[model samples]
Target: MASSLTKDSSGIPGSEKTFFGHPRGLATLFMTEMWERFSFYGMRALLPLYLVSGGTAAAGGSQGGGLAMTAATATAIYSIYLAMVYLLAMPGGWFGDRVWGPRRTVAISASVIMLGHLTLALPGQGAFFAGLALVALGSGLLKANISTMVGHLYDGPDDPRRDGGFTVFYMGINLGAFAAPLVIGTVGQQVGWHLGFALAAVGMGLGLVQFLYGTRHLNPRSGLVPEPLTREERNRVLRRTVLVVLAAAVFYGVVVVAGLYTMNWALVPITVAGLLIPVAVLVRIKRDRELSDGEQSRMTGYIWFFAAAAVFWMIYDQGGSTLAIFAADKTDTSVFGWSFPASWFQSVNPVLIMALAPLLAWIWLYLARRAKEPSTVVKFAAGLALVGLSFFLFILPLSAAGGGKVGPLWLVGIYLLQTVGELCLSPVGLSVTTKMAPAKYASQMLGVWFLAVTAGDCVTGLLSLAGVDLNTTGVVALEAAVAALAGIGVYAYRGKVRTLMGRVH
Candidate 1:
């Protein structure tokens, strides 16, 4: 199976390469990611408004979607959804590594996500909530494993095209992110949110078909079936599954009680318990010998990077939450005598990502040549700092609004800065996983990385509760706290992180 999944470091699961400058396998994965992201972000762009829009107020609190939810409620729901998706990525990663492999996992996930989108597009309340759940689970699975398959594209540790391939791969993700909001969000605003959900369903369907069609080029190294497990391996898998299920239960409870949409405050205890289990796992890993010395060190560094980056994400992903609402509710969007819908502003970040990704790739390449390239830790800190700067940009127009509308250009500017910060941090973090993680534990570590983003997203939900009428000082204060906390964490962990990184070429 491994031999069949292997490619000549250019194509997909079972094929050879050609003159297109990339493996044939990468093409399908590329479209798969693109459409997956399109489905995810397309729904994402409209979710805040759907929750806050007047037609659906009963399920939401007086401050949330069905009601005239304060911007904070919308932000809270957005952040929660984002967090859950990332958190589920852990299970998704494990399922791929232990059971399905990346290809099947991605395929199944895409199908599931399509179903979720269909549910969201249905004509009633119960379907919408249920659809959201399917979407979260599907995304968690796909987001974790798709990149794992990409890593499989390279046969060994020293493939030169791996970095470039990842860059191109991430570009696919951004391309989807870029297009989904414009297409789906605009349609949602025009026809109804249901239309946007339907579009997302179509997008996921497209991604699924693309994946099925391109199986010939898949990397031959995928779908590694484990031999029948011994007692220890079997026990370990069983234990981990139990822990994961328990943790997910708890976290869902907390998120539900806190969210206006899935108002299930009844689960707070479960959420608290869920939050603690992962920390306990880390503690066990620190004292356990299941990992090699190198594995131990890498896992330790991952924990910090995961946590620190989560802080960055909490602040960074606000683009979809607080910032989305801000654009919708308060931004002055008229242009050429046509007032632009706030949903359109979601396009700004992807555009900036498209623009900045190349420069970041070049900057890293230039630095690598000069032997002056920053370590992953350094780059991550810079990401945190850059996102911090982006948040400050909001203060100016937010303050100037003074209970009046702020110009949409200001929101555009903020997204540009945020997109640059994401370019610096988000995709690079994916690269860091492949670089630092040992093959034996790669998928697990990827899961950890995603979990961190999920944790940060959870915090974003809680923090979004801080205010709806956020003024310039309030926005500044919020951002400053995030920046300072992230900066301090990064600095304190600097030495350990470098030591774990070893000498990279």
Candidate 2:
């Protein structure tokens, strides 16, 4: 069995040959995640626009191709969908750790995600909702495990290439993200929404195929469950898994039957789950007798980082919801007399990340060599502050436009700032989680880290419900002010957080 394979006496597998000075497995994981991100972001770019579009045949008319939802409703749905995607990571990671292992879990996830996109290409609201559910579930399974696998590629905590490898892997994510909006967004907006969705399905199919073909290159350890269950325990777990799935199905059915399948009703439960799960996980970690005091303190620091991350994402993720609407309705898409699709704006951040990732990776390594690297908490503070400033930047263009369409450059500038923020915080967050989490619950703790994103998405949903117009100056300023305050608050506590982190930074 591949899972039983081990390194030769030289401590290297035949397939462990270097790629860009890292293991060959990095290339495989990189391309796999790239395609997955392409599929995910491609589909997402179309969602808000599609929801509000009318299913009419009028060119550029809002009346012919969408569900005809209001901006608030559509934004709310988008936020909830994103929230669920991260929220389910908890169980998905647990399943990988306790049952399927990362390799199998990732494969299953890609397959389901592909199927979900295909289903969305079909007609009817029923298909739409079902497809969203499947995609969310699949994303939950894939997201944390892939990152965990990247960490597994390194032999030890002290591996010098670990951070660089993650940065490279993150670039793959952006590569896919960069292409999705250009390709899928154009197809969905101009060719037809269904065709765009079909393209996304194709992207996932390619990813799964590539991953299956390249599995041999990965470390064999990645394929085995961390702690396999006993035969009796496996049977019990199987039964419980079935029951949980069935119960979820019944709940959705009841919601539909009760005519409560709207955004407002859905937000209530999702928000509660998003907020409570991380808190519960933190409490569990604190009470675990197996952890040393140092580990506990590190976990406490992680929780603080998690809170700041949630705040950062609450502002950053508006790119798909509020920002998407703004691009479609308020921004000038014309450049050199050519009008671009609104969804293409979604590509900006990824494009920037792809361009900047290598530089940032080098910078971090350079700083480390000089013994001047910023602590993880400091990076978190910088990221939050940058994102807050990005929001503030929008105020300038909003004021200048004064109810007229603003130049696309304004959005470009905003994305540029936000990309810097993402670079500082996101990859760092993943690395820190792996370093700090207890060995027995590594993958689950990663899931807990992602719950910060879940919380952000839920909060975004509520914020969207306020119905703030992107073209309005007062609302834009208010958003900028609030984000700035949050960023400042996090930075102010950097000293205390650094103390908690101890030697992990």
Candidate 3:
């Protein structure tokens, strides 16, 4: 049986070669992730604009096409939704490691995600929030497992193809992300909101179909448990799960009965959990006696990398929130006598990523052969600084426009800088996380990696509560300084971090 196959073996038994000289399974995983991202980014592109469109509030809703939420409320919901998506990845990874395995978990979660999008296609505010919750749950479950499956495709830790493979995979992500806004955004903004949501549902359905069909190409190990729980452990987990569910039900009933159910009230616990989970995970890893002293040391350095990533995403993710708002309200939509949808601007970063990722991948490979490749720490520092610079550059157009609409090229330039920064950090971080992970906690470690994003997104949501316009000069300046300072700090201490990392790089 394929489940008995060795993890190091590539794909489809003897027919291992295909898909750009990589494993055939990569093509399958690639397309699956592509369609999933199409659904994800499609909804993201439309969400902010839809929230404020009609200027009505169901709980707070739109005109004919939106929920009509205030800008602050919509931004908070967007950030919270993003946070929850990554936040649930922790348990998702645990389930993959101990219960269902990555392949099964991915399949199950993808089905749930399709349902979420479909729910969003339904009319009414209740359906909207329900759909977001469903998507968050399913996406969180699907994301870490799928990426872990990709890592499983390579031979081992030292395989030269691992980083390159991840880069190719990252490109698939951008290909989907690039197209989503153009298609989904246009429809959502111009047609009906629910129709745009239905398109997202179709994309996810397509992804699931292809994923199921292509499972044969994947390693059989993907379907087998890496660390199955003992009977005693399983019983304990079941009891705890039941208790948690009951508690949640009780809380929901109490809130509904008391007439105290508000969206912000619901967000509070989620926000708190997002802030706490990464720290809890780190503490758990630190306390684990199974790891060697060297492994523990590497984790110390990983903390620094984690912090840098959180800061990067805190700013970078604004492309769909604050920056999207800026594009809609303050940027000139006309180019060459044509006015475009503001959501179309969201496509800029992915398009840049699609164009540049291959070039960066080749450059990294070239540098590695010559022993001149930058350390992961160096790359991270560069990424932080570049993102900071992107925000800082926004000051120029802000000054020139004097509160009037700026040309679209200004956004293009900003996205260009941010895209390069993402290349420096994101794919590199994924590869490094896989390499540095302790064997017993492989999938869980990836979950922890996603927690960086969760932390950043949670902070983004909290910032909305401060009532600061994210597009203002003061806000932009502060953001730029923080990232720049972090980059400088990381660069200054790279030597020490390298020592902690030992030989991993």
lDDT of 1 by residue, 112-144 (tens): 999999999886667877898899999998886
Q: What is the Å distance of residue 389 in model 2 from its true position?
A: 1.1
* Tens-digit lDDT string for candidate 2 (322-401): 77877887788989999889999999988888888778978999999999988787788889888889888877876776
The C-alpha stretches of model 3 lying farther than 4 A from their native spots are 1-17, 56-64, 151-165, 365-372, 399-403
Error of 1 at 13 (Å): 21
Give every collision pair in model 2.
Answer: 54-62, 54-63, 54-64, 54-65, 55-64, 55-65, 56-63, 56-64
Model 1 residue 481 CA deviation in Å: 3.0
The lDDT per prediction is: 0.73, 0.83, 0.86
lDDT of 3 by residue, 1-505 (tens): 1232233335444444466656778888999999999999999998888777776322112235577776777777888899899889888888898999999999999999999999999988999999999999999899889988997888886877776777678888989999999999888877888999999999999999999999998989899989899999999999999999999999899999999897767777788788898888898897899999888988888999999999999999887887787777678888999977888998998888878977997899999999999999999999999999999998877667664778999989989999999999997898789788877777567778888999998888888755656767888899999999999999999999999989888
lDDT of 3 at 105: 98
Better of 1 and 3 by lDDT: 3
Supply candidate 3's per-residue lDDT for 235. 100
Q: Give the Cα-based TM-score of candidate 3 against the true structure.
A: 0.90
* Best-matching candidate per TM-score: 3
* CA shift of 420, model 3, Å: 1.0
